[model samples]
Target: MINMGVSFKIPNEYGNHLSDILEPLPFNYYQWLINNDEIHIVHDNEFTNQFLFDEDKIISGEKLYEKSKNNTYYMVFVTLRAFLKDGTIKSVSKYKEFTESDCQIILAVYDCSYVIFWCKNSQLVSKMYMYALSKGYEDIKYITEEELIKNKYYIE
Candidate 1:
């Protein structure tokens, strides 16, 4: 079963670059997404006007279509966790980014078991990743585009 989480917008300035997570990337991040073959184009549009206030971050319609048409700037991140039948906790955090109006940054966390998704555009996601790594999440694995397309998890 896949647990979903809320999608959040984050500023580019806050998180450590994806490059920091995995270096010698096969093409820059943007290029990697655009070139990927299996990504299912489910919802692509301008997410600009969906917000009534800064606190209410929602993607507007115009930008949505623009995303579908261009297919260039959007990026996504995902993480998956596996658990033992005996009640051991296993989790992974995957993250990504896309261009949004009034918001240049994005962040998200998906807790599958509780069906909880929390997202905030603050620099917190990147900070949290860094913190986790420092705390010894050394086995953290970066997903490739092929893997992302095969397991396209969206927030419904």
Candidate 2:
């Protein structure tokens, strides 16, 4: 397994505020999203996986649009379906077209497949739970700090 040794610093205000509104999720990616400003949102697209990694880090969707050259606007919420494996640590996907300029690389490890959403707006993180529920996603909850410290290998 590759150890990236990345540590995330989630602002106390952001974490505390998000927890109150959004259901606590157990997925590591969700925890990472709460802490980090930019991420690669990946999902299946027919025969291959499609990835959308932010070109630049921004605090909100408005900032993202202002900074983007294309002015592309992403929805406030999105879903990702990925196949994760233990001992497999890859910062960039072989099949996906991502580079250092595209996003801040993150590391993850898991023993089973999981589905989660990645968002940019901290305030809208909780709203995703309702969207997921409407879309039929089951058992959506937030991951506690204790659980994150115990199970997650990537500290940031």
Candidate 3:
């Protein structure tokens, strides 16, 4: 079963540069890295407004489209446990199967416990959710964008 937690959006500043800001992270961090620019497209124009807010500088949809044309936006999920086949934890990057170029979002399953799903296409987001389920990943919690913002400033 999918466990619904607080859903949060990853800050715009942490957009494509997640690797730079996140520290003291779990070992399977590399699994969240997606270099496929083709997978980050915003399919729904209506929701483009939200992205505009995240981008902060885009004044119009045309501009947003142009700016993101070559870049891919990703939503990554990180889990608390490792889901590797060998039960060995190592930082590594793996490429996803490029079945289609129209894929605009990515659901990054971290450590098999935490999940981060990023994308402008709601359809793609749903697909990723189902994909996760097909893989037998049920202990999933959705973090809120507000939580992410709050976590960014979290001081321990």
What does the lDDT come to for candidate 1?
Answer: 0.27
How many clashes show up per model?
24, 7, 20
Candidate 1: segments with Cα more than 4 A from true spot: 1-55, 58-106, 112-131, 137-139
lDDT of each model, Cα atoms only? 0.27, 0.29, 0.32
Q: RMSD in Å for candidate 3, one decimal?
A: 17.2
**If scored against the real structure, what TM-score would every candidate get?**
0.23, 0.27, 0.27
By lDDT, the better pick of 1 and 2 is 2
lDDT of 1 by residue, 1-156 (tens): 121222222322222222232221111111111111111222244433222122312223233233334432222332222122232232223333221112222223222111112223223334444444553433333323344334454322
* Model 3 agreement with the true structure over 1-156: per-residue lDDT tens digits: 222122223333223323321221222322222222222224432222233124332122233333434333433333221222233332222212111222223334332134454443344445545555554544544534344434431111
Model 2 is weakest, by summed lDDT over 10 consecutive residues, at 8-17
Q: How many backbone clashes does candidate 3 have?
A: 20
Comparing 1 and 3 on TM-score, the stronger one: 3
lDDT of 1 at 30: 17
The 10 consecutive residues of candidate 1 with the worst lDDT sum are 28-37
lDDT of 2 by residue, 1-156 (tens): 222122222222111112212233333322122232222232231212222334432123333222322322222222221212222222333212212213222222122112333322333344554545554544555433343334542222
